[model samples]
Target chain A: MNYSIALKTLVVKEVYRFVRIWPQTLLPPAITTALYFLIFGKLIGGRIGDIHGVTYIDYIVPGVILMSVISHSYSNVVSSFYSTKFQRNIEELLVAPIPNVVILLGYVSGGIIRGLLVGLVVALISLLFTPIVIHNLAITLSVALMTATLFSLAGFINAVLAESFDDISIIPNFVLTPLSYLGGVFYAVDMLPPLWQTISLGNPILYMINAFRFGLTGVTDVDIKLAYLMTGGFIATLTLFSLWLLYKGIGIKN
Target chain B: MKALSIRNLRKTYHNGFEALKGIDLDVEEGDFFALLGPNGAGKSTAIGIISSLVTASSGKVSIFGHDIKADNAKAKSCLGLVPQEVNFNQFETVKGIVYNQAGYYGLPRKLALQRTELCLKQMDLWDKRDTVSRRLSGGMKRRVMIARAMVHAPKLLILDEPTAGVDIEIRRAMWEMMKTVNQQGTTIILTTHYLEEAESLCRNIAIIDQGHIVENTDMASLLARLHIDHFVLDLADPLDSLPVIDGYQLEWVSDKVLNVAVPKEIGLNRLFAQLSARNINVVSLKNKSNRLEQLFLDLIDTKAKGAHA
Candidate 1:
């Protein structure tokens, strides 16, 4: 329905938004990833030995990249949407003839672009510390894209629920950050006790990181197929929910 | 056919404050219609509903016969809204802002650029096309907004307090440009606190207050309904005492000058008769039209007092 133009423009604008504010949006994540590679991968990897027949550095690479993807995607949507709300320019699009689905896709596509771009940068920088390898290019790309889309939708939802600048940071600080770090980003769920392992499975991000780790190193604590299915389910659910919120004009109308 | 029609539009905030209770209005094709009210008088709410920015609780709005709720896409395509706030993407140039707005309406890049240029030039913003929107002055930013709204060339233009904070010179220019647009067959609907502007430019006006339309009529008829005029009399002789004129309110500001309010039908003939009867020599007399500001204040004050009663 002539969505390609809308998608393309939105993605370009989204990418430009973060790129234009490189110090605030892009640099902090890159520096944080560097620290993770240094303190977690090198200092801790030497003590832990190996995980699933791979060195700790290589094992953590996929998780680090996936973490970057999730944070970047979520932040992109939240900040962009919140800024629009603050500036009130969103009324322009709200008053236009465009379909709600098109607006959803356009904003989501922007988030995806930022998430994937930052993910690529993180992956490339990891090579400086340790050699990287790919087990399945298709699975790797699919998992990364789907995970970005899912988190971007989540960010969109957060932005819609947020009423102020403080509101925008609440979910990321209290919910998203804690969920990502505990969702097996640093270690395999198998390393936990059986009860803890089962509980960790409940975290949606665990499935996404595991699927991505499997794509990169062909090793996973959970079944690779289950990981793929769960991530796909997440993407579908979040997309539908976000579209519903858009149609209802949440946070947009009084 | 009516270019725009609204029926029983109502809006209430979550905090239980009713911004718009119920308003009905109709703007004819090629008409320059103005919606006039004071701050917090529901002018913005009415415009917001018509432009689809604010949803009505229980009402209907249509653009050129298309129901906004049922055929939003078709209805919205026929409308262009210039909001009161200067909200825009600060990072983009003026040209980019206009172009992106057109793209949002599903226009192709080529067509969007063409329309953007045309609109920019029309708003006299062509010289500042490449500058970022943030760097422009307040007036320039307002002009950029007008350009963005006109990019799609909608059949109806809705402006919400377009010149609220602008200077008089810029406001005059904006009014002239708006008149040109109205002349081109794009029905213009604007809301403003400037009563003089509405009196001079609008053929029809609607006065909304407390979510209800208190007054709606042609400009001429509304002015005639006030039925008030003013006379400034210059006397040849110094007045130690004021002369009482029946059926006219008089104030003697100085010995040589006296101001009076008289019904329009009661011309200066009666005033001259009173002066001659009192042996007051008259040097010169001038008549002044009733100022719209007084009428607006009187209407709103009367309405407010009535509500309290």
Candidate 2:
């Protein structure tokens, strides 16, 4: 496999696919995130001033940005990949001499790009509701990258196992949405009771949102070190599992 | 080296359905080969396995001496398979689709562009290069598939029912293009329900039935097995019934059209003499069906009966 050319080509195709439908792929996130900032950051935060010694709006901005990354990243890979399987166009890559790693990374890169783009849009939208400030630029960007990659890999796994379009939506709707909302995107885990706090630790997205929040406000209820480690761990595990599935040709091959 | 070699290939689906039962096949380099089989006869499975779209259970396939499993990259690099269905992204432009396939095959940007141009031109799709594939007619979609398969210039190309929905004019044009490509030293394997296509284009053939190769031989040799010939005789005048003649089975297709099945041993001259003695002047006499169709039907029928036995 000439991994260079094959990977690049796949990346270009994936990018083209989403970019060609920008109204659907890129616009919805901006509008939805802007609405969140307007309602939660303005109206609600005006009533409740500071959260953990910081303005309520600033405290939630990082969480909102991270949330967008997670949603867009997962949706990009799930819908695009599931569509490929549904249409049977995956055979184009299957028959090629490209390695499974190249194919995986190609699709993952597409998701990452979309997630990052949507995350950027949401961040810009947040600025309209509050003054923008980055406490640690490195932590913020790294957390964003790690979260996007993790969710994209999750989406890929979901797409692989999906037999029908309905199967694709079940996880995002039932599992992903609930997990993200409870993951401290709007409030800190410290606000919950001891038992609920412990359960929040198990949610996994809590670590992600906390990690991004710490990068933005330097105030994360969870230990930032453990947050980074957990994100890295989930990413490594999902990456290995995805490669194994592709190698086995489990669901992709009959 | 053979263009393609399958050694005792077998595929038993998870539900205990054995789709391919240890079939062995070999196609010579640069030879136009036809793998003919009815629906569910495992033609698609065989192609799927060779293209690595489906896994083989117990045997090996080699392309031009490259083992498909051990030397997968090399083997796949030498082969292209156009599946039975249209599988390209329907929303993609025709040019983008072809270029992407070439890039996946590891062609550099420059080379991929050149090959894309040439293939689209050969398929007469140059004018529709910018059109989204789904907007084109069914025949055009099939042509786009052919061009996509040709992008990397693989040593061998396998087309599964490539002309299934194509009209006669486009199908003939496709045949001409394939013949020209074959002459340029690219081995081709074609599968179609149209027996006339196999008889006219392929030099060698293998007929699979019920997961087995019931007949595998050169085109001429296979045709030779059809010792019975059928003719459609047009009568000079309408007749209510046809007279019985020994050594011939006559069927009345219509008042003026009669289907005559004559054995090779009886000869056409003998049939003409029989008709002449009866004062029945024949307006026109044509072969009822192509010879390969007859042989294919016989082979499949025999295989079915054997399975039942």
Task: Give me the TM-scores of chain B across the candidates.
Answer: 0.88, 0.98
Residues B179-287, candidate 1, lDDT per residue (tens digit)? Answer: 9999999999988878778888899988888777888999888887766777788888899987788888898889989988987788678888888889888888776
User: Cα miss at B285, model 1 (Å)?
Assistant: 7.8
Off by over 4 Å in 2: none
lDDT of 2 by residue, A120-222 (tens): 9888888888888789999999999999999999999999999989999999999989999999988878889999998998999998898899888888888
Show the lowest summed lDDT stretch of 10 residues, model 1 chain A. Answer: A1-10
List clashing residue pairs in candidate 2: none
Computed on C-alpha atoms, the DockQ of candidate 1 is: 0.58
Q: Which residue pairs clash within candidate 1?
A: B21-B211
State the number of backbone clashes in model 2.
0
Please, what are the lDDT tens digits per residue for candidate 2 over residues B1-309? 899999999999999989999999999999999999999999999999999999998898999999989999999999988888999999999999999999999999999999999999999999999999999999999999999999999999999999998899999999999899999999999999999999999999999987888888999988877789999999998886787888999998888899999899878898889888988889999999999998889889888888899
Q: Best candidate, DockQ-wise?
A: 2
True-vs-predicted CA distance for residue B246, candidate 1, Å: 4.1
For model 1, the local distance difference test gives 0.86
